[model samples]
Target chain A: MKLTCTVNGLRIEATAEPRLLLVDFLRHQLRLTATHVGCEIGVCGACTVIVDDEPVRSCLMLAVQADGCRIETAESLAAGGELSPMQASLHAHHGLQCGFCTPGILMTLEALARSGQLPGDEDGVRHVLGGHVCRCTGYQHIVDAVLAQAR
Target chain B: MKPPSFAYARPGTVAEAAGLLAQGDGAVLLAGGQSLMPMLNLRLAAPDTVIDINGIAGLADVRRDDGRLRIGAMARQAALMRTPAVGEALPLLALALPHIGHPQTRSRGTIGGSLCHADPAAELALVAVAADAVLTLLSSAGTRTVPARAFFLHAMETVRAADEILTEITFPASRPGARCAFRELARRHGDFAIAAVAAEWSPEGLTIAVGGLEATPRVCAHLSRELAGRPFEQAAVVRLIDEELAQTEPLEDGVIGPDYRLQLARVLLNDCLAEVLPP
Candidate 1:
């Protein structure tokens, strides 16, 4: 099957197996490894990505399903070699320990912020952040970072 | 893990999709792919063919007709919260939407998919049963509507035929002054509930469905009769759950035991009833 989509403002097409997952296609074919795959099932949001401006579990979507959609990953956050606000906030708030879950959380919050759906308060941020699992930083700093940006 | 290689077809119409499904062996309908894709990747389901129904037009519409809230099969879970029609017509569903998975998963999960997947712990199926929703099933032969109570046969099981497609579900609009509430217990926010309760109190009566404690959403007729036309009493609800759950024969569901399941069910039921009761 031929998979085609705009990733981070670039339109690209590649041949992939019908069973190829969007996460694998992004990581392997596109060489965009920032989007991590955790818990191959849909439970973990580690494979989260923005498809058509909404966050979705890339691991649970096929490359074919994304054929005409506009997708944005964590790589799209940085601008001209500068850290995006979300990245900078994560840094200032100490949001990452091992950082395996950082990219997915960034993409999830990126969509929330882009769509003007970012929560305005701590509880709201934590509720939205609850979608993505973070094994490190106890989610306090992550919540702090998101709340910082959410403000 | 990679899903087993399978043939895929995107049919442009419901008739085409139904024909494809009927002709192919182990063919499964794919809507939002939120549930089906995960099952496929886990190798828990290896259908010979996947018939993507996203291309089928008119299946995603949510309309209100003659006091019934009609939700097309492809109606996404997120839309229940975001769409004005769904938000106003189906407030119960709107209340339950955020609890489905997460905002992201809800963006791609559909009503038909969730009901067809029929997880006993899932919120949508329980809401459907609580509302006594009616489902419209279509196949190459014809169409039929089944009550939500009869549609769900067991966990991950339904009365829907292999060749039939669930096209829509309809819930009668709530009566004036009716109130509904949903409560569940899970390790995390987005995880599946260990035990859950969805309840609605109205002129019709107190309709309730308890999930994650049985193969399908369990409705206590005796309790509903006792609950109608009266203020909620926590002790009575707890006693009813105690007497009923003792004979439930809970399955060994990996994490919790039968006793714990009953306890959680009681707690959730009490919590939900308290929320929906008159102030």
Candidate 2:
């Protein structure tokens, strides 16, 4: 199947198998390897991406589903050599250790902040990130990062 | 994990989508794909064709008319949560919204898909039952509205025919003085519920719905009758909880035991009742 969609700010097209996952297509076909596949299942938020202004698990979506949609990945958060506020906040708050879950968290948080629907307190930030699992950081710093951004 | 090979069709109209589903053997309708994608990857479901319903028009609108809230099947959970009418008309659904998968998953997960998937532990099922929502199932022939009570047959099972597609869900708007509450206990925030309860109170009586401890959403009509016109006393509440728990038979999954789930159901039900009852 030939699929075409805008990744980040660039329009791209590729012919791929119908079974290819959007996450794998972005990483393998487009060579944009920032999106990580942690739990091929939807349980983990490691495969998060923004599709049509909303966050969705890329691993759970077929590459064909991305047809005619606007997708934003972790790479899009940093443009022209500058980091997005979400990326900078994650770094300042030490939101990542092994960095496996960082990309998913970043993309999700970016969408939340950009949508102007983010919670206004620390506990609210923790509640928002509860979907993503991180063996490291204990989520204290991630919560802190979101809280800092909320302010 | 790679999904088994299958033909994919993006239909421009609901009629075309329904036609494709009817013509293709073992065809599955794809909405958000949050639930179907996992099954496809695990090879638990290998449909011969997938009818992508995303391109179908008029299936994503959430509106209200004639004292009923009508939500399109493709309306995302996040979109439903953000709708002011949902919070105003059905506050229990708004309360349950934060408990569904996180912001990301909820942003793409649709109420129609969740109800169609019919997970025994899903929060939406409990809400639908508590609110007495109506599900509209459509096919090439026509459409029919099935009450939530009759819509779910068993775990991951629904009354929807293979050729039919779920179109919309409708429920009476919440009364101005009605009070509703939802409670669930899971190992983690986003994990499947160990036990969950939804309760709504109006001038007429109380309605209670339980999920995650049975094959389908169970309505405690006896308990509701017991609480009618009677003040919510501790002894009465305890006896009602005991009776409800005694009637349920929870499955023993790896996460928790049936006995533990029964106990948790009682505790959560009590907690939910406390929220709606006045001191």
Candidate 3:
């Protein structure tokens, strides 16, 4: 099956099997390896991406389902050579250690921030970012980073 | 995990989608595909064809008319949660929406998909039962509305025929004095609930629906009847929990034991009732 969708800012078309996950198509077919796949069952938030301005689990969505949708991955967050606010926050606060979960976290937070309803306080940031799990950072710095960004 | 080889059809209209479903013996509707994707990948479901309903027109609108909230089958959970009418008119649903999955899953997960998937522990199932939401199922023959009470027969079992596509879900506007709360116990923040309860309190009576603890969402009308005129105290709440557990069987799997789930049900029920009930 040939699937065409707007990825990042570019419209791309590729032939894929009906069973291919959007995450695989994005990483393997499109070579956008920044969108990592973890906990393929959708439990881990490591496969998050923005589809139609809303964050979703790319691993849990088929490539065909995204045939006409706009997809933004972690790579899209950083344009030109500068990092997105989420990436900058994660870096400044050392919110990532292994960095495997960073992309998913950034995508999820990016969606929240894009909604323009993100809180402007520490507790508010904690509540907003509480949905994503991080094995590293003890979550304090991640929380701190979100809080810093909120301010 | 890749899904089994299957033909995929992206129909532009519900009539086309319904026709596709009627043609294939084991055709399944693909909406958000949050649950279906995992099931397909695991090979738990191997339908010969998948009728992609995302392209279907007029299935993604959320509208309110004639005192009822009508949500299209394709309306995403995130979209539903953000709709002011849903938050204002169907507070229970709005409250349960955030608990379905994380924001990412909710972004694409649809209300109709959740109800049709009929997970015994799904928050939407409990909310549907508690709110007495009506499901609109469509087939080539026509359309019919099934009350939530009769829609779910067992765990992951719905009354929807293989050829029927769930079109919409409608619920009466929440009463002015109605208060609802949802409580669940999960291994982690986003894990499936071990046991959960959705409670709605009205001056007429209370409606408590327990999910994840039974084969299907169980509505304890007896408890609601008994709780009438009685204060929702610790003892009264415990009695209701005891009666609910006594009437329904908890789902037992590798994750949690039945006894543990029964106990958690009691704790969650009490907590939920305490929040909704006056002191």
Index of the highest-lDDT prediction? 2
Local distance difference test, each candidate: 0.86, 0.88, 0.85
lDDT by residue for model 3 (A8-33), tens: 98999888888788999999989999
lDDT (Cα, tens digit) per residue for candidate 1, span B1-279 = 789999988898999888987895789998888888988988999999988887789998988899989999998888777888776776777778888888878889999999999988889898898888999999999999999999888889999999999999999887778888888888888888888888888876888778888988887666677778777777776777677666675645877887788878878877887877654
Q: Native-contact recovery for every candidate?
A: 0.88, 0.86, 0.64
Model 3 chain B weakest lDDT span, ten residues long: B228-237
Give the docking tier of candidate 1: high
Candidates by DockQ, descending order: 1, 2, 3
Interface RMSD of 1: 1.0
**Model 2, span A1-151: residue lDDT tens:** 8888999989988888888999999999888889999888888789898999888899888899899899999888788889888789989989889999999988878888888978888777888788688989999988888888888
Q: How far is candidate 3 from the true structure (C-alpha RMSD, Å)?
A: 1.8
RMSD of 1: 1.6
The DockQ for candidate 3, computed on C-alphas, is: 0.65
Instruction: Give per-residue CA lDDT, model 2, range B28-81, as digits (tens).
Output: 999888799999999999998888898888998988898889999999999988
Q: Which segments of candidate 3 are over 4 A away from where they belong?
A: A121-131
Candidate 2 CAPRI grade: high
lDDT of 1 by residue, A1-151 (tens): 8767899999998888889999999999999999999998877788899999888999988888888889999888896889999999999999999999898889888888988999989888888877788887899999888888888
Model 2 per-residue lDDT at B252: 83
